[model samples]
Target: MYRRTRRAVVTSLLVSSVVCGGAVVLAPAAGAAVPAASCTVTPGPNDTYVTISGEGFTGPRKLNDGESTVDLAIGPDGTFLVKRFQKNVDYTVLAVNEDQNFIFVNCKKVGTAATPKPENPQNTAPAQPGSRRDIAQGRAAGNQAGTAAAAKSCTTKPVADKSGQQHSDAYWQAWTQAANRSFNRACHTN
Candidate 1:
């Protein structure tokens, strides 16, 4: 005699557990199916700033270079820009986007991979007290301070002098001189 039997079996993986830094994280049973998020890396002026733009991201986002990380300010449209990003030499940047349900990782290389050597090692000496570099830095600082002072002193914006429907070189020169005088007085006066 032969007897037939039926059985019910559950074979789906309900949840997955991952151990991270002595912490156990239970994965979600199910989530919405979506395409992986990505970002574009663009090197800015002298490779000092890096602009990252993309879409379709949620939750937190950041840029990492293994040792340090910078948080990205994501807009409502999912685009981000990293102004004044300090690029590391010989390193790959890791762009991360973390949502409640998933984590997206993207790797990119920014700036020169090799360390740049000074063209003239002798000329790479530190800036002296009255050196050109020092003067430039001082001038920059003074310009910023003076500009703020001038702006605060003036009730309205300074307008450049112009001829009838046209501006001459002399007029521009005079205008610049006046502005320089104003700034110099504001910054250098005791």
Candidate 2:
């Protein structure tokens, strides 16, 4: 009976043991439901900095953050494993080199799928630049600037005194005044 109990205990202890370099690790059970896969990014060619982070994962996974260089595992299949992360969140390189290298994200979810709300309005694509939707929504990158520039463009340009005729003082003065008026209308400048 004692031997049976000992064997039971030993078997229970071996439930989650992972052997690495003659060491044993008792990993936590995922509690019946399988966890989600994670997104990962490596520094592409000419990338001076890179990182990844998201739900169900630990601290920031980074290659650099302007503080110091990071030792990144850049294998075709990286050799490190932490807790899993969720899928479909923007993975950005928070703070990176002055010149940014385009980041490419690749991941596969191996477990339960992420459920998104049906017909979510905010899930629609953002307004196109300079489109009516962008201007109305105040999301146009040049909304205010474009309006101000249009105001300037609407006024007719000043006619220069390039008619090589010798003009009297009164004629030159009147021409200057007309030019100033056009300038005021165009730029709202006195």
Candidate 3:
């Protein structure tokens, strides 16, 4: 009976040591950190649009192409409304903290299916130089036609400005505002 008891104690100690070692190994190491927030992107099959969602991603994040980065707004809960992506395009979204380390969310490569390109090409002709009355009338007519065409072709609402530069600027501003807010809140609390 004493021999059996001694063997049981030894076995228990061995088991406990193995278990504790495994737990430590599985746990995150000290100073090895994850971002305070994260994001995910749901790209449509055709790659025309993506809905981005995350937590603590409010403000602006950068959308990077190989050569350049564009600022884009993140909703309060880390959501973004994205559009105008080409089919099969791969993109990366990054949120940078003050320390400059970034939390990156890679978007899936979109497939070319389900969504189709518009059959009717948009009119790109410049407005004709004319009298004030003619110009005003032409502008009104152009707006109406554009609205109708967009409503017919797009599943999602058209972005106010389709020019990439303008869109990028808007996103930059949003991110700046969000950063400022975060800074103020942190400062006040401390």
List ranges where model 3 is wrong by over 4 Å: 1-56, 99-102, 110-190
Overall lDDT per candidate, in order of appearance: 0.44, 0.36, 0.46
Model 2 residue 63 CA deviation (Å) reads: 14
Per-residue CA lDDT of candidate 3, range 3-36, in tens?
A: 3543444345445646666321222345967445
Clashes of 2: 0
How big is the RMSD of model 3?
Answer: 24.0
Candidate 1, residue 69: lDDT: 53
Q: Which residue ranges in model 2 land beyond 4 Å of their true spot?
A: 1-35, 40-47, 54-148, 151-153, 156-190
lDDT of 2 by residue, 1-190 (tens): 4335434433433432322222232222446332332455433223333234333222223332222223333333323332212222323221121121212122322331233224646535555554554344432222333344436674544444436644344444444454555456557655
Q: TM-score-based ranking, best first?
A: 1, 3, 2
Residue pairs with colliding backbones in model 1 are none
Candidate 2: deviation at residue 91, Å?
12
Per the 3 Å backbone cut-off, how many clashing residue pairs does candidate 3 have? 1
Q: Itemize residue pairs with steric clashes in candidate 3.
A: 60-175
Best model number under TM-score: 1
| lDDT, candidate 1, at 136 | 49
Backbone clash count, each prediction separately: 0, 0, 1
Return the lDDT, model 2, position 176.
Answer: 48
